[model samples]
Target: MAAGCFYVSCLALGSLGSICLLFTAYWMHAWRGGFAWDKTLHMFNWHPVLMVAGMVVLYGAASLVYRLPQSWVGPKMPWKVLHAALHLAAFILTVLGLFAVFQYHNQQKIANLYSLHSWLGITTVFLFACQWCLGFSVFLLPWASEWLRALLKPFHVFFGASILSLAMASVISGINEKLIFSLKNSTHQYSTLPSEAVFANCTGMLVVVFGLAVLYILLASPWKRPELGILTDRQPLLHDKE
Candidate 1:
């Protein structure tokens, strides 16, 4: 029950964070002028960061369901390591891509950076999908030799971690850009325009809430179990019925 609740909480928080981020981006674009589909799409250039982050929290939570004590089946050591690595990489690439998108304040820079960000972001997503598929297969049907599984784990974990870390940095960069914009335009007040800072603040709050929820689930879940040597080993205990 605790495990289920933890997974659900993480998923809920992740979904809310994604929604808030998207809505805030749309609102900012709308406030600037009438909506252009292209411009709106461009505004969502940083969306991959939120998407990857949400996925990480979600997948991480799901992992607990299968890996925790008392579960029907837990991932073998090799598979577990791979899973962790892939998630981390996804997070890093998404963050870096987002940063690249926000670094451009001018049209020319935006144009230039868009390609770079898109390619890197797409690559990250592809890698994540591959890793996820591999994980699912391994979990569902354990066919690989222990040695082979062990060999693959570290490579997978390292790349995934790299991606996620970079993706987070990208998110920070985007927020920074917004802050700079606010500072520059604070003196001029439009008749009906909402400040960019407001949108950024709301987004930040959502991220914080979601992050806390994820952390709570991680810490609350039962990852350890009491040691029982006989129970730990694969053996059936017989009950005496007279």
Candidate 2:
């Protein structure tokens, strides 16, 4: 029963995250005029799309790898490698997303890093990069002391969850910022609830819900990965009898 519930939660998270990504992409392309990297307005569109895909969706999924029921009984090395690879991919895409926004801002002669969203984004990305490096060194390297890994594991998990929270905040703030900027002077103002504004609001809500679901999965004790050697071919996971 516990494993079944875990699978259901994972499915819910996957579906929500996918919808968030799709809604973000559609908002950018259909309403924001599509994406390009040619220093035009189109370039700004990539900022939201890539950030949602990389930081929120992929990062959330990567964080759950160890918790997968299949991972509980097997060697953990493969799961560790996969976790690191997913994080690396997320980092690359996040960097690209930052470039898209920064490039567009520079081309338009707008000051950078002046908004709450920008501040949260830059801080989250920097800390996320540091977190990944420290995790790789302490968790993945062969020479790392067992004591060191044990000491850092809690901090690693804490910071990972914290950074994800920051990402969610940044994305929601960015959505608000974009809507205000886009509709402040238009016939269909944000206050009037234009279709674009409504859709964007829905997208932001999706992101928030997705983030909460990921956090729930991360924190649920019954779903956590069992300790090394705790599970074997003949043994069952915690709560398995339920």
Best by lDDT: 2
Q: What is the C-alpha RMSD of each candidate to the true structure, in Å?
A: 8.4, 2.4
Residue range with the least summed lDDT across 10 consecutive positions in model 2: 230-239
What TM-score would you give candidate 2 relative to the actual structure?
0.95
- Residue 29 displacement (Å), model 2: 1.4
Candidate 1 whole-model C-alpha lDDT, 0 to 1? 0.48
Scored against the true structure, residue 240 in model 2 reaches a CA lDDT of 82
What lDDT score belongs to each candidate, Candidate 1 first? Answer: 0.48, 0.90
Off by over 4 Å in 2: 231-242
Taking the tens digit of each residue's C-alpha lDDT, what string does model 1 give over 81-133?
55456555545644554554455333334453354444554565666667666
Q: Kindly provide the TM-score of model 1 when superposed on the true structure, using C-alpha atoms.
A: 0.49
lDDT of 2 by residue, 1-242 (tens): 76777778889889999999999999988888997779888998999999999999999999999878778765788889999999999999999999998999999999999999999999999999999999898899888988889999999999999999999999999999999999998999899999999999999999999999899888977677767657543334444856
Task: Quote the RMSD, in angstroms, for model 1.
Answer: 8.4
Best by TM-score: 2
